[model samples]
Target chain A: MKRIMILVLAITTGLGVLAYTTHSAPQADDVKVISITAKKFDFTPGEITVKKGVPVALELTSSDRVHGFSFPDFKLTAKIEPGKVTRVVFTPDKTGEFTFSCNIFCGSGHEEMAGRLIVTD
Target chain B: MKKLVLAITVLLVIALMIGVGVFKLGLVPVNADVPPSGLETRFIPIAVHASVANHAEEQPNPMVPTDENLIAGGEVYTVMCARCHGVPGRGPSVLGASFYPPAPQFTVQPSGYSEGELFWIVKHGIRNTGMPAWGRLLSDQDIWHVVAVLRRLNSLPSAVENSRSKLH
Candidate 1:
């Protein structure tokens, strides 16, 4: 009886902790999906705007080689492999213009491979 | 003996479950701004050093640290690396400092990595770190040139220093 009671207590505490933890990935219907393509030295749609507080899913793909997306302000980074889509989801809590750039060295023009993210209140 | 084995197995199973729960429940901090914990500070360097030693080829730098070669490396460094690693005369970059494992200010504190290790790291970036692989973008010769510059960052040739100063 003591062993059973201990097990029951452990399960209850585990469930409570899991429920309390914040989960960021929102359901499909709740997120606003945006498709962005990366090539040699540019992220198509060089500028993107999203409403603050709304979960935004950026579906990134590369047409040339492996590229990377780093939104430093959001602390989000992902590799966009050629012939594959990498989905990065996050909610913009603050409203501002943030620069997103390709952290991966692509070519001579790699330094210029950057875009802007405009988060609206 | 059988009872001891059974007790150990049960403990292992419980530990595995807890580990999985922590990750699946997003309990692990993923933020980049937070400083690394003591555990990471102690173990990560050991792991990186071991990995570099194991994977990086045991070889010497092919390019001689000639003034021209050093200058060439400086050009690449000024364009590609200075933004994060920092330039000799300038301060640490704000963008570089914001990284989870902050990008080392190599100019301020010269990297202890050997030429070969630097070559391997520049060719293939460290995973989960902000450093990016330049293999696809830079030729082998270019990489060697960069390595040459990195080795002599504290004592760059006058010509290279002059060229670096031209960059803002």
Candidate 2:
């Protein structure tokens, strides 16, 4: 009975550690780099598509004022300031349609400053 | 009596097993886009409040609410909190609402937390939430200044409001 209990504890602990360590690390594939431009209230490439489970590198630049790129689906956000390139890297874990929007209150059309991210499996 | 106890134990074990299986199977929704359930909105704050109570020190804000401090706070807020918490005149931040717990819209609804509580939250941040600890990036004075700004969001001085307005 003592040995059985010890074995169960060991297995549970091992499984917990394995799950924690190996859950979100995707294999090293060529990062799909995409450049996005932000202005008053819009992303230049209004729509972006990438493969699920692959790493993506986004090079974000702003032409005027400070803009925020918020992709809530992936819990990603970056500040795009004029005269600076903000690089954001993330792996899309889910395959679906996600909306990326400017969170910063830029101007009258800030609400409409949104784009779509289609992650394909 | 023995049989009844045994049966109850077996039933409890089965229910526990089912609960663990459901969680492990990913039946629980983790999507950030969906509005938080009533249970989450109600229970999570309770946990946060208790944790804050335990960890937060009862330190009063050292910074006075002068134009200089308030304006400084506004600047920090614009660069840091505005994206998640929102700014004045922007109706219901879409990005703020998209977080799992949803970042509080300080512009629309002023924080009810006390100066000390707000200070602790801003400095340390809530765990497992969208809030990030600014202690590393911002100085202690900056945190206190922002706390003052939060306390006066509804009634910011004209100078501070004007500076914020220029951003929009």
Candidate 3:
């Protein structure tokens, strides 16, 4: 009977902590949304600034050809197809500057496609 | 255990010998005159992709595309880039053929590089090619001006045409 009581207390304590943690964190839907346009070899409004801990919804639009958008530091990659909108929701946990680039091959100057994301504490 | 170690050692030495032989014998094509092998052609794109993706600048071309800016860009292009890239109404340049991977003709091939992309290329230039880094020679504003001119490489605006000198 004592063992059973101890096991039940432990389980209840674990459940309480899990519930608190889940409720404290922000959800993807709660983050702010920003639209970015990707063209032959550049992204408009190249520098983006966001607050740490808050999630952001990035809507990517390709103006001309199919381009790739990748935040290598964050291990995030998204494809931006012409005439289509690609939505990516991410929460930056750390505070620093991150570079995002196009991993796909477009043309001769394809390599010069990169942008920066600045996160503040 | 001793026999196993001996066998492994023999195999390792054999592999090293083969590697050395390939290098000393000149079995691999090292000359730029030779067209790139199939494997090299396949690999070069991946290497260039990784390099450009890593180094490209994020900022858009800061200089506004004014008429003066375009003319300056045209003059710079005719001076710095035309020796290899060729100029308008002048047939292919003899120097263009000298390069292993021939210098691209802007009149024939229009690279869809962005303004910033063009600026970066003109400033830093490409490696393993005839292109040389102009960043040390040109200022940032001048590079942007060059990019403005490249935008209309094939279809030169009248103003850009007026900017070109007879020497080009």
List per-prediction Cα lDDT, in the order shown. 0.85, 0.83, 0.77
Best by lDDT: 1
Across B1-168, the per-residue lDDT of candidate 2 in tens digits comes to: 999999999999999999999999999877787778899888989999888888888877899899998987887777677878888767668888888788899888888787888888987888878888665445567689889988887789899999866755
My TM-score estimates for the predictions, one after another, are 0.59, 0.55, 0.50
Name the TM-score of chain A in model 2: 0.75
lDDT of 3 at A48: 97
Ranking by DockQ: 1, 2, 3
Off by over 4 Å in 1: A1-121
Q: Candidate 2 at A101: error in angstroms?
A: 27
TM-score of chain B of each: 0.93, 0.88, 0.79
- The TM-score measured for candidate 1 stands at 0.59
Better of 2 and 3 by DockQ: 2
Q: Candidate 3 chain A — worst ten consecutive residues by lDDT sum?
A: A102-111
Please give the distance, in angstroms, between residue B98's alpha carbon in candidate 2 and its true position after superposition. Answer: 1.2
Model 1 - which docking category?
incorrect
